[model samples]
Target: MPRIPRTKSKTGLYHVMIRGNEKKNIFRDSEDKDRFLEILYYKRQNGEFTLLAFCLMDNHVHLAIGEGTNDIAKVMKKITVSYVYYFNKKYKRVGHLFQDRFKSQVIESDSYLLSLIRYIHYNPIKSGLVNTVGEYRWSSYNSYITEKSNFPNLIDKQIIFMMLSNDPQKAKQLFIDYMSKETQENFMDLTAEENVIDEKAARLLYMNMLEEKKYKFIDPIPLNILQEVVSQLQAVTGLSIRQIAFITGINKNKVSRILRKHSKLQGD
Candidate 1:
């Protein structure tokens, strides 16, 4: 079947996402991330687009951008190609670095635009990379909150800030308040919604495992059972090590050790 065309953004604004091939880490180190950002900044010199927000996770990236002199496709192509070349050269690898076609959703309203920005800013938190949005260094959230960001002019915050309030300080405060709220609001994303298991489900999995094994006591679980429990929690529930530890009352380090050992055993 032929490919479907991307939905055209009437307002020339979109929420764009791209990930590494097979869900691998795109930026191996800080230098790699810096280079990618450098390319992103360099591409904008032509005035082809306006970047509003961005978050660089290990394996993927989220961008809120508005088309100016060129379409979003052309803008993304320039940015991705430049970075991929640098990435492949540095790693002494070849072939595609990015996955299939980049995903995007049209942002035609101010409400949706603000929500998308919030979601993009919150990506690191959602992925358990950082506990707070302010703690993450690779996002545009700091740009909105601070006047002295590393790349202050890379993103255009005027429109979003104005929407929050006429007063700059008040707008910043409001933006912070809005971000602080716990959100169940969903938006377009590459990861399937079902893939992320919540705390309740994770705990249920642990409880059910103990009951199945006819084990009454939670503490001092047999060594073999502990390994199986940790490995199964990861394999079956897809919960992170921290989450698994929380659910099973296991030390996070022990959980990591179990998974690593299990993986090594499987490899052998």
Candidate 2:
């Protein structure tokens, strides 16, 4: 089937998300985050896109960007390509870093725009990274409240603030209130909605083994049971042979042999 076209933002504003493939950790450390921010700042200059708000999570990212001289796709392409190169080179890995087709929701209304900004800023809090929004170090939350961020990268806060009120102090207070209000669409809930983990078979198989006095389908597992246990565990948990060996106290080569047999039978 053909792909559906992306919705255009009338106000030239879009709420965008890009995630790691298979929900893998994208920002492994503070250095990675800083490197990504540097890329964003450099790319922002090239693309001329206005960075409204952003939050960098461990496995994914949320960005609120205003339409600039370049199209959103092109801007994202530049960022993704450059960052993936840097990331792969640093980690000594390859292939796609981000999932295909970055998800986006158009910001058409004043209310939705305001709400979306708050949601993006509060992502770290929703993920339980910190109790309060002010405590999170990776989000643009501070830039909105403070004069300037400690980082070299900058956020365009004037547009959102000016929308609230002409009076600077009152606008700041209003923004604070709006940001701190009770929220429903948090980072955790949204990511969970998108991530569909396949654990049904694993759960059923584990339960059946437990019925037979097998604690975890390991330790003196007969040849008959070895295939079943290893197969189900691989399907359910996506564990590597080494991990299974560690968990089961079985030799790594033995675990590999069982896994190989299971794959061969399935292939046939």
Candidate 3:
């Protein structure tokens, strides 16, 4: 069966997960994790995307990202591709460093958004990698609580803090309390799903909620027609319009117009 197409977000806020190939280890040591973070920082500086929150586990990684000048897919590709290259070189072994495709879930609701932040922060604890979230040095949990500037672009602390408390300091403290042992809440739990269909349905439902505001395709074209154009373009070029525009420095609107025109010409 063909896979369902990925639904893109205009504003680019996505909860992304990249796991090791075949459930293998992505990080051999602290150096590997640090290298990944460094690549993330470099991508942010290049204005590819903004990292809202992130957690680096031994076998997988989680990130909440807001699209910046580039789409999330491209941004992630650059980060992962570069890291894989370095990883292969350092270890003198290679095939695929990460799973074929990273998993992404759009965050649609304020409640789910908050839950995601908590979920990501609590990953290490849930995995038994650490007894407390704060004990995990690779995650953004402490940075979110302390207002530290180490990861300027990795997390949008303002949003989380604002949600937690009206006062930033109070919010930080509240977030800390939530992650503390006293809370007894398990945020990292995954939902039960019988199969891929069930999981995809759940993901779509979650993504739709995250995108509550109606966004017409970046082009003013009708929805069905626009999708057809996107399909044709992807089939021929193996590139998303967003990715093409980012690489070529063309306006996304122009790319959409070109694709629409090309589609019309073909039909004629």
Candidate 4:
């Protein structure tokens, strides 16, 4: 099938995601992640784009960018190409490192932009890599809240802060409050399924349900609760058993059995 053309953003602001090929780890170590950031900073200095926010994960990356001298596509090409060359050379590997084209959603409103930033910052926590956004070192969260920025030139925080308040201190406080609040915000991601829910959305639903029941999602949930979760996930997401298991950390065979029992009960 021919690929659909990306919708041009009138505001020139976008939330972009790039994943590693075959769901492989893009950054094998700290050096790779740092090098990717270095490339990003270089691009920023060159007037490529306004980097509002960024989160680097093991197999993927999320970026909130505003257009500069070039369009989003051109900017992504420059960044990804540069990094691919560096990565392949350093790792002694070849071929495409990134999976197909980078995925992106247009950011036209300030509210959605803030939500996107929070979502990006919370990626590490959502993936169980950390307990909180601040605990993660690979994202731009610190740049927004810290009194002194380690990479001052990397993130364009003034635009975001100004949106929050005229006073810098007040804006920082507001940002903290906004991020601290637990939300059910969802956005475009790499693992989206056509006509069905994405992985992130599914995970958010599970977490919300668990939270409402006063059950910590990170803890071992009861078998009955797992069954309910699996059934709901299957019905709402239309995702496979493996996908459900991956999302909930349940065994594939158990997820299937849970679904079977639910189906039998519904039929009766």
lDDT of each: 0.78, 0.72, 0.66, 0.82
Write out the backbone clash pairs for model 3.
51-154, 108-209, 108-210
**Total clashing pairs for each candidate:** 0, 0, 3, 0
Error of 3 at 94 (Å): 2.5
Task: Please give, for residues 205-240, the per-residue lDDT of candidate 2 as tens digits.
Answer: 544664465643212347767678767777878877
Per-residue lDDT of 66-135 in model 4, one digit per residue for the tens? 9999999999999999999999999899899999998887776565577778889989988899998888
Colliding pairs, model 4: none
- The lDDT leader among the candidates is 4
How are the candidates ranked when ordered by lDDT, highest leading?
4, 1, 2, 3
Give the Å error, residue 224, model 1. 53
lDDT of 1 at 21: 91
Q: Write the per-residue lDDT of candidate 3 for residues 27-133, one digit (tens) a residue.
A: 99999998999998877888887777899888889888888898777888888999999999999996998977777766554544555666788788767888877
Model 1: per-residue Cα lDDT at residue 199: 48
Model 3 stretches with alpha carbons more than 4 Å out:
147-153, 181-268
- Per TM-score, the best of the predicted structures is 4
Question: Quick one: how many clashes does candidate 2 have?
Answer: 0
